[model samples]
Target: MIDTKKIRKFFPAIKAGRIITNNAASTQVPVQLLELLKKLVVQYDNVHRGQSHSSILTTEEFESSYDTIAQFIGAPSRKNIILYRNATEAINAVMYSLMTEFKDGDNIVTTFMEHNSNYVPWYGLCKEILPKFGINVEYKIVKFDTETGALDLDHLKSLVDQRTKIVCCSGASNFLGTINPLKEIKAIADSSGYLQPNGDKRSYLLIDGSQLVPNTYVDVGELDIDFLVWSFHKMLAPFGVGALYAKEELLLKMRPFLYGGDMIAEGMVSPEKVAYNSLPWKFTAGTPNILGTILSSQAIRLLMDFSLNPGKQKYFMTDKKLERKDVKKAMDNIEVHEKILIGEALKILGDISSLNIYGPKTAANRTALVAFTCKNKSPFEIAEKLSNLGIESRAGCHCATLAHRYYELNPPASCRLSFYIYNDIEDVRKACLAVKKCI
Candidate 1:
């Protein structure tokens, strides 16, 4: 199956005797991506602003990076891709762009299991921002099953109605580790007969794919999502680049999230009026993270290569357009590998007396992460002890405050261990055994 030995060589972190299991926050960059970053720095320049050869070359790579990201996710084209600082900012962009569109009586539906990035934006929009403007748009949160950590689709259906303008949900929970059924969620969102300015008869679906995109293959066209957001750091790339993929039609009609130079068409501005640039650039305002964007795109290529040919460099540096089948094959292999790792983690950690695991018990129902709480043991203390044992773990709300409150956790915390491509069965065993030692 997966060559863990070969894959571990690409990441220098594993060689340094570091057990990097806290991957849900951010993954370590491979040596390949680090080299790519080094190569990009010499010729770096601001995109769309300079006429030098370096500018043109860097712009070419930067723009092509969008194509790579879009192709990886099965988006139609680069026109549908928009770059942001992170997934949170991308979701906020949607909220601001559609702020004026929400009527007084309309409501937004989201799940209780969502990361704060998804929930807090809508909460601020409906409760804080819109209220000051005299708009009373309501935000309704659907509950989940506490035992299984699964979204209650019936409750979601009950929450969505004709007045629901948007439905936002996470593709996977960072704390609970549950992979939500997006297609079924889309079906429910589509049934909401909310009239929009674009003449659409259903609510728009926005998926927070920060966790799901890194672990599984996501096809936006097939899923019929209006918007999708994810961060590159969670994958193999470094920080400072996240992606937003929306339908071209939606990007064309919706207002620009940020406005500045290069967003306007050349020479189309006058004292009287100004015209905006075309599809993707209109959304990209000021200077972007050129080096980070290139590395992020190359990270996708490297991930594909790693999945297909573990130790080889078949697709990493190539400029070839990524094929859909190759993406599916690579993601499927990663999914299977992660499932085995998480399954072992669940088995080993579940053996500990009084340790309660969150999310689905089966590996198939969740991503490659395990969060748990124990009786009479503080999660923070457990995490600290695991750290002393050289086992990396996260202990906090994990940006899932609502879900922690839902479970009635006293300190609003749980210990989590998440895996990536470089992690193997041994890594899971050590992390779990460390947890056992802590308890």
Candidate 2:
């Protein structure tokens, strides 16, 4: 029910006669954001370090950007939000911030379906960092069902115990396109009898929402999540900006991941002691990505406008506070639209006998992406052929090496075609037919 014809007009990539279906890796930038970038270049200035008129104006936009991002995800406030280079850095921030809190026998529980960003940091922490300090921390990886691509919750329950410090999982699988059951995962994390330094009796839950947040609505307060990380690049903005939403209490207790200028309090540093800045700022170090932050926040507003009323400026470039109802409606529309697109894709791609599709069989249980391997064709060859046919697709592990290895793929790869709001049914049809033709 999304007016894809109208939505496609906002993207230059679509107008260039190129099919952009590689959205799981990164979405194409909209023309509005491009124009907004041009306008921002005129008055660009470093925030929080200058007294000039341009600096003050730019600082206001940069700081208000936090408010917009916080509002979009139903975060309590800007205090709980921290901006990073990308989702990988955000996850690393959590790992580093809580590095010292791990006990000798503590374990971190994660899934086999996680992207490297979610798994590697914990791996490095347990294998490389903690052992140097004589702390014998362990990491446990939960398994998923190979047939349905569903997470094995019973196995996750068996892995978690009193010693489990944190539970990390992806909100959706990039390769399988599986939308994980977060509430169920949260419940499992809560039941773990791990006593925390903060007097909590459960493991902290961190969700890597790089795939989920961009495609669906996520409310931090409602979910009671300890940490959430995602990249704006996958959500329609340009690269160089990612987000971390943690509980304010947890952010206050954890150490800063990076430290330098801007993180320290103004005029508070002395030879004896140096105090850090307030919440959110404490985690942000050095000169931040000023223009990227502004454009990224504006992208959220523009996305709502694109879903609700295309070619209209109700939310974009405005200072109005985003209502929770409007956010839900906008995201619900997107989820529904994606279901239709993925449903059509599943129907067409399922008919190919040589193609073996991964993830949920139905659109209701997954995101708007499909990854498959051909019986006689290499995934790389299929992707190259699709590119030659004017279609965009991704081939490789898609940074999902663990999942690919789980399936026992020799090259540990698959060809992926992902859809976004701007992608139409015709695009899905052409892309699937092209895959059939390629194989």
Candidate 3:
């Protein structure tokens, strides 16, 4: 029921005969997003904390986008959404806050499947602030059965304990498209995995929602996550913006990670005192990508709505929701078709005697990503060969070194071909042929 024909018209990259398959690295921009971005740039002007007409309009536009994005992900309100440059900034906001909240002997829990952006900062904090608090940084550890490459969930549960203060995790592995059960993870955090003699929850759960929003509906309230981070670029918005949604109490306690301009209402850091703003602007320093944020709203409006239940309509998050029924159905249908196309590609590529598919066997357990290693071919070699064959793919550790170890591919792992709404059966067929030719 997905009209790939009509849908294909919106993405110029897919129509260019390039056969793009590197959406995991970056998705091709839709004409909808592109046009919106173009409009902003053409109508460009500076925006800052001022009373000028242009600044007022621009600031309003930027702040308004937060509401749209909040709605897109079922956030409580625009006030809870903090904008940033990318997932890294969004993750940093939470990481720094975690640093402020915990003391020695407190613990933090995460997995190896996290992108370096998610992994490195926490580790850095563990080495820095955790020591002062006598806190131990524990991990669920990223491991896989070299044979199956499935998630080691049992191992994950073992890592949570009485002292754990934070549970931050990626919603899906960017490398292998492995979808971790956020709902289950949230439940575990809510109850601390029955960690007590009678079982009392001990950690606040945060989700790195960058990858999940594109693949499915993201209702943060439904997920009951304490914090969630997502970048606009990954979700088809401009690259300069991302959002961090956190619980109100946590936000109140957070010391500003970055400080300057807009962050302070009245400043008197006169060698003796430092004053700050009262609201969310405490964390926001200086002028932002006001135009980019404005245009991001336009982009968010243009994306597909993943919900289907008509009765669940009241739970819809957007203030100006995309009222078009056809677009939502088309988006959902496109996702279903893309899954099938990617699955067929997996079926063909999975059997190549020379190739080793890492991660789940069935596509349902994963997002629309398929990664594989070959007998002796370097990941870059395969990726280059596929590129020469007019197919697009990405290679190397994929910022997922743990995923590399999962397949016993240490230095570099496999090539990844990620599918999107614009990708169709022919594109998958072409990629399959390209992979076949590589062998």
Candidate 4:
């Protein structure tokens, strides 16, 4: 179990008595990251564009940030990692980069539970962009069980055929809080007899891990994930930095999504000929978010430290290599902690006769978030009332618009309360009790 009493001290928001239960949208930044930002600002300089001491130092830190990110996700190396403005942009990068690879009759498979970011790009590519180019591609959406909020694996298998080129799925649903059965999904994708230019006989798998990576352990190598994308803000850092992890071979073959300045090799751009930089950098065009990248990487380290040893600095602010065993242990602890919190929340919220909670009934089947609707109250009204009681809650579709509509929600919205590492049992009790009071 996490030492929430010690861990809560690191967050000024908690100290200020604010109930930060809306962690699914974005987690609160810790004091260490804020302090680290100040130190970084003093010596900050543009990376890879200068030859001064500050530039050299900043560049080293910025580049090392990629290593930290790659290690956290069990990526082979930094070559597989690319930083973006956010997860939406990172997923868009995959769509754009692989745009030319889609054939006239190929189809893309995704789920109704996806955030608009994961679904819309493919929708635009298949319905809008590709059609104009005389390349007709189809986008198929998998269905979920409305009652359990679980993906319909049999339905997904039926949808995926030889014509399917890529399968894009969310690692976890932001609204339903359902942690998808990724292994089963991967097996289904693997069985698709879609031929690829890379000589693979299966459709590619792209996981939108925005909700999964922040709260659970993810091993890209073990999962054989072709592409993974997530935002750092959802974890613990300030906004503006997201990550895309693609196979090195795929990164080497796929064209860069953006092309400009740093993306090109040194002295290789001329009127006669132009050559792009090596893997990863080829995708990182123009000036990147240097400070945000550094802070985001530090946030991963700090998250590990917070989970493994609260009120201590074993990984944060250190140059130590994160051990795989430690990563699993830290993340497993966080998962267990969240299960307990969500379990308690489910029990309390379930007792409210007027409310209907969405997603899995048991905490073991979902993440730490709980989304629900009230019979006598609108979600917005409930959220505002909860806020008046100093409890933070989010009321909306939560970006799982298709899923919200799947439930036939009148307004396509629900109120959500989510927990994180710094949140304790008391926070969960208070948030759920406040929801009861609001209703």
Model 4, 100-124: lDDT tens digits are: 9999999999999999999999999
Clashes of 1: 0
Q: For residues 1-439, what per-residue lDDT tens digits would candidate 3 score against the true structure?
A: 3446665666787677778778776666666666656666654666555687766766667777777766667666676778788788888878885575565566677776778888778777877657666765644453545444455666656666666777878888887677788777766666563242223455788788777767666677778888888776765555687778887667777778887877776755567767776656777788777766776666555555322322222322344554334434534664576668768888888768888787678777677788887776787888899999999998888888765765556565678888776677888888987888887
lDDT of each: 0.93, 0.94, 0.70, 0.94
Q: Count the backbone clashes (under 3 Å) in each candidate.
A: 0, 0, 6, 0
Candidate 1 lDDT tens digits, 198-225: 8989999999999999999889878989
Off by over 4 Å in 3: 132-149, 193-201, 266-275, 305-319, 322-334
TM-score of model number 2: 0.99
What value does the lDDT take at residue 193 in candidate 1?
A: 91
Per-candidate TM-score against the hidden true structure: 0.99, 0.99, 0.88, 0.99
Looking at candidate 4, what is the lDDT of residue 161?
99
- Which one wins by TM-score: 1 or 3? 1
Clashing pairs in 1: none
**Residue 14: error of model 1 in Å?**
1.1
